[model samples]
Target: MEAYFIGLSFVLAAILYPLFIRMLKIKNIGQYIREEGPDLHNYKTGTPTAGGILFILISVLFGVILKVPLVFLLSLSLFGLIGFMDDVASIYKKDALGLKAWQKFLLQIIFAFGLVSLESTKPIFGVEVSRTLYNIFWIFVIVGASNAVNLTDGLDGLAGWVFITAILPFGFLKQDIFAIIVAAAVLSFLLYNTRPASIFMGDTGSLALGAFLATFAMHYNAEDALVFTSTIFIVETLSVIIQVSSFKLFNKRLFKMSPIHHHFELLGWKEEKIVGIFAGINLLIALTFIVYKMW
Candidate 1:
């Protein structure tokens, strides 16, 4: 069943790729490069946006068919919709920035609350955790994961590969259903999202992917392992946080550029090479966690 879903997701994504391209052109929906970002990214302007919808759709289709869980489907779709709105706003405003921080946070909180409410009514996997704590944890998972993926989207295919690699630990724990579906979806997205991407996942796909992984972690009681599993995201987000803090606090710079990847780019590393290095590190971390769990 898992293999079938994987293959099915790949095929479905392949079929949808050209259609998405047409839709993007029809709607004139594309990305805007931030002036503050690396000059290398200037060329990426006007590339298709909202490609993450295809990824999310593929995963939801398979997940629903497999009867994974209502909460999973609801949470994934709800978050995806929020991301979709943000993507739309970016394109409409012709700005690289999408939703305001407060706006996005409010929407995320609503979705997280909805998931918590659902989980409270029918606890997933029979795991016992207090409702209030669970709600708080869910908020962190949803918001943290969303932003992590958003930060990791610095290089082409970097976020996709990192997400795919992170899902492996969950698979190893036999908590494979949600992770498998997510892996399949990301694999499908990678068909176009690879180096020289045909389309960017934008906020729409990244946030959805992040939220789904967070939900999976919560479901499996593997939230503890998420730290190691999501090491790449943590590192990426930390780089930005540290950079911002240092600049504001001391007028000092941490990295030549934030998010760590741009620092590598400024150091003469090609985008593809940086992505490969990060993805490899993410894979190693995930594998290490899986091996430790087995022992």
Candidate 2:
């Protein structure tokens, strides 16, 4: 059953992407390149975006059909909606800045709270936490994961590739068919999203993928394992934090740019190379953890 659905979602994503890209182009909905980003990315300006809407739609439909927990679908859709809003804001404003940091953060908090509302106090990493603390921790995970994936989405197909490796562990560890199904859709999206991309996932896809990763872990009591599954995302996020802190406190910049991948871009690494390396690292981490668990 799961295999059938996975194959179906893949074909659905593949078929819908071209039509979606055409509609986005016709409507003039496209990406706005960040002026401060790598010069190589300037060519990507005006490329069709919000391509994530299709996969999110596919995932939600399958999630419903499979009768996965309602909370899972709700969190995924809400976070994806936040991303869609961000993408729209950027398009409307004609700039890369979409929905002020505080606005997006606040919305994530609200929706993250909604996600945790379905659960009471629970053990986190084998340690029980108070109800309030449990709420706060999971909320942090959801919001942080969303932003982490958003930050990682700078390069073509980078986030999508990393997400595939990051989420597949759930399928192996807990037989979570939804994880496998989403992975299939994401793999299909990468066909167009790779280097010299036809469409970008923008914030819409990245945010939702991150949210789904976190919510899936939460559902399975795999929060601790998420650190391993999401190693690349954590490192990417930490690079930004470390860079910012260094600049503020030490009057220095750590990497050529924050998020680390941009640093590699500056180093003359091909976008495809960076994506491949990062995704490889993510896969290695996931497989290592899976082995440990199985043994």
Candidate 3:
């Protein structure tokens, strides 16, 4: 039964992307290449974007059909909604800048807080913790994971690969059909999202994937494993933080660009090479976690 649903999600995503891309093209809605990004990316301008909407829809629809808990679906949709709004704002403005950082953060926190508030205020990792601190920690996990995946989406097929690997262990360890379905759907998305992409997932896809990861961790008591599974995202986010801090405090630039993948791009690394290496690393991390758990 799970296999049937997972296969259905894959086919659905495969079908939805081209249709969505055509609709976006007809509506004259497309991606706006960032001014500060790699010059090589200029050709990607006007490519159909916000392709993440299709997978998010599939996940939610399947979640409903499967009778998966509402909280998980809510988390996915809320974050996807945030990403959708950001994508729309970026397209409307004709620039890569979408919602302000603070605006997005505020929205993420509000929704994350609401989600965690409903969770039991039990001791974390068997350590007694205050309710305030406990809620704050989970909120941080959700918000942080959302932004981390968003940061990692710089390269073609990068986030999609990492998201699949990162989420698969959760599916396997927890016997979660929903996680499997999400991963299968994302795998389908990668068919069109690879180098010389036909459509970009934009913030909508990346943000929702991150939120789903965090919520999945919370749902399965796998928060510790998530830190390992999401190493690629963490590193990508850290690269941006380090670059900004170094330039601001020491007046020295650390990398050619932030988000580490762009740094590799500036080093003349091919998009395929960068995605391959990063996804390989993410796969290793996820496999290691799986081994440790099964052992």
Candidate 4:
């Protein structure tokens, strides 16, 4: 039954994406490129934005139909709402950057805190833990991962592929039903989100997906061992952090571009090649994580 649900969610996502594209009247809704971003991306202007909403809606509806816990449903919905707002803001501002830094952080903190409170007060997948520590740990995991994915969304299909990699190990663990459902929903989104994407996940998809993965990882208490499982997202976030810190402290650029993928792109690698190579690497890492953990 669970497997069936997973398969069904993916198929549904594949079908609904194009429909939503039309309904939202989002044709040629290009991303708001940062003035400082790579010169090549200037042409990406007028690509459709807010496509992430389709996947979010699909995932939530599927989860609800499967009767997932209210806590998880609420958490996912709240994060999706935040992403939706950010996406809308970006389109309105005509800037690639959506929410201001502080505004985003504030919202992330609020959602994370709310999710942590819910988890601490309830039994997650039948596992119990200290409420105080659980709440604190969840806040870090949720907010950190949510932003990590948001940062990784610079390239076509990069974040989506990385997310698929991260979710595989969790499915192998089979510790939480919600995790599997989320993973399935994400996979469905990836069908249209791959390289030369028909539609991008945008902030709406990335933020919600990140929050879902983070919350599920903590819920299953997979933190200590899932280090490799989340490597793609972590590396993406770290690359940006390192780049910013180096520039601020020593006026040095760490990578030609931050998030690592853009660095490769800047180095003259084709976008398709970079996506393929990184997706392969992410798969390898995820396989290793699963093998080691299950052994």
Candidate 5:
């Protein structure tokens, strides 16, 4: 029964995505590749962006179709809307840096604060942690996970496949219908999203995925599970943080480029190789986490 929802959403996405592509192309809603990015990616500019709207739509629809809780649907809408705003801004401005950093961060913090407040009274392993601290950690995880995915979107199908590895296990292991729906939908999107890509998910897909992941973690109180399943995202975010801090403090870069994947690209690694390597690592780590959690 659970698998049925996954398969249904997958088929829906696979069938509907080309239409979305044509619609975007007709509207000239294209991605703007960063000028500062790897030289190989320069040619990818102007691919129809916001391909994520397809999966995001289907995922939410499946939730509603299946009569998912109001709380989960609300959370999904909130985060997806935030990503949609950034994606729309990027389209009009033709700038990869959309909605400005501070604005996005503030929005994320506000959302995080609201989410944490819902469970503020829950005991933290028998310890009384301040509500402020709880909200801070949730904000850190939710926003950090959200942006980490944005950074990982450099290569075609990279973030999509990596996200599948992080998402699929939750449904089967935890019986989460929402996870199942999202994972399957993402896989279908990856069919067109693969190397020699047809369309990019842009900030819309990346941010929506991040928000979905963070909300799932909060839903199940599985923050630690997120660290293991989403290790690749964590590493990518850290690379950016380290690079920025290093360059600012010591006038040196921690990597050839931040977000690790670009650093490898600069070192002559192929996009396929980087995506494959990270996907494999993500699967291995997630499996290990599952085994440990079960033990």
Candidate 6:
């Protein structure tokens, strides 16, 4: 029965992306690539943004059909709203910068704090902790994961495939029923989101995947193990932090570009090769986590 939803979502995503592309184009809702990004990506500017809406809608539809808990679906919708607003603002501004960093940060923190207060989220990897500390840590995971994915979205097929590698193993290993369902939908969306992507996932897709993956790991009481599962995201995020600090403190750029993927690209690695390598690294992390759990 669960597998049925997964298969259905995969088919739905495959059907929905092309249709969404046409609709978004008609509506003039498209992505605005950042000026600071690589010259190679300028061509992608104005591609249909909010392609994340495809998977988010699919997830909700399937969640209803599958009778997933209402609270979880609502929570997912809330996070998606935050991303949607950011996407909308960026389009209106005609630039990739949308929702000042502090604004996004505050919203994520509020959402994470509210989520952790839920009865089901009380347990953190089966360990008891003070509520204040737990809120801080959970906020870190939610915000960090969301932004990590946002940063990794610099290249075609990068964030989507990396998320698949990071997410599916834990879902299957832990028998997380909804994770499997969402994964199927995301996989189907990837049909159009790969190289020469017809549509960009934008912040909408990035935040949905990020918040969902972060919460999904917590849903299974495996937050501790998620560090291993999401190593690539963490590394990408850290590269940004390191670069920023270096520039601030010593006036030296740490990498040719931040997020590390851009650094590799600047070094002349093909986009396909970089995505493949990162996907490999993510697979290694997921496999290690699975083996650790089994052992």
Computed on alpha carbons, the lDDT of every model, listed in order, comes to: 0.83, 0.92, 0.90, 0.75, 0.82, 0.83
lDDT of 6 by residue, 1-295 (tens): 7788888889888987888899999999988888888888889887888888888898888888878765457556767888888999999999899899899889988887776666353667677887777777777887788888888888888998888888888787877677788878888877888878888888888886888777776656678767887888889999999999999999999899988999999999999999999999999988987987888
Best by lDDT: 2
Error of 2 at 41 (Å): 0.6
Model 5: per-residue Cα lDDT over 100-206, one tens digit each:
88888888778766666665344344456677666777778777887888889889999999999998775556778788788888899899889888899877788
Q: lDDT per residue, candidate 3, 49-153, as tens digits?
A: 999989989989999999997778988899999999999999999999999989999999999998787677766676878989989989999999999999999
Model 2 clash pairs are none
Give me the displacement of residue 45 in model 2, in angstroms: 0.1
Lowest-lDDT window of 10 residues in candidate 6? 114-123
Shift in Å, residue 266, candidate 4 = 0.6
Q: What TM-scores do the predictions have?
A: 0.93, 0.98, 0.97, 0.90, 0.94, 0.95
lDDT score of residue 277 within candidate 2: 99
After superposition, candidate 5 runs with Cα above 4 Å error: 123-128
> Of models 3 and 4, which has the larger lDDT?
3
- Give the TM-score (vs. native) of candidate 1: 0.93
For model 1, how does the per-residue alpha-carbon lDDT over 1-295 read when each residue is reduced to its tens digit?
5677777777788888888888997888999988899998988999998888888888888888888877777767888898899999888889988789899989998888877676643243456667776787778877889888988987889989998888766676766666676687678778888879889998888888788778777666667677778899999999999999999999999899999999999999998899889989998988888889789
Clashes of 4: 5
Which candidate comes out best when scored by TM-score? 2
**Ranked candidates, highest TM-score first:** 2, 3, 6, 5, 1, 4
For model 4, how does the per-residue alpha-carbon lDDT over 1-295 read when each residue is reduced to its tens digit? 7668777777877777777656555444656777887888776666666677776776678778878766667667888788888888888888877888898889988888887776534444446657776677678878898888888888877887778777766766755655666776777767766766656777888888788777776656566435676787888889999999999999999799898888999999988788778778877887877777678
In model 3, the runs with Cα more than 4 Å from the true position are none
Model 2 lDDT per residue over 1-295, tens place: 6679999999999998998899999999999998889888999999998888899999899999999888889877999999999999999999998999999999999999999999667799999888899999999999999999999999999999999998887677888888898899999999999989999998999999999899888888889778999999999999999999999999999899978999999999999999999999999989999999999
Candidate 2, overall lDDT?
0.92
Is candidate 1 or 4 superior in TM-score? 1
Please tell me which model should have the higher lDDT, number 2 or number 3.
Answer: 2
Model 4 CA deviation exceeding 4 Å by range: 25-30, 121-133, 175-177
Q: Which ten residues in a row have the lowest lDDT in candidate 2?
A: 168-177
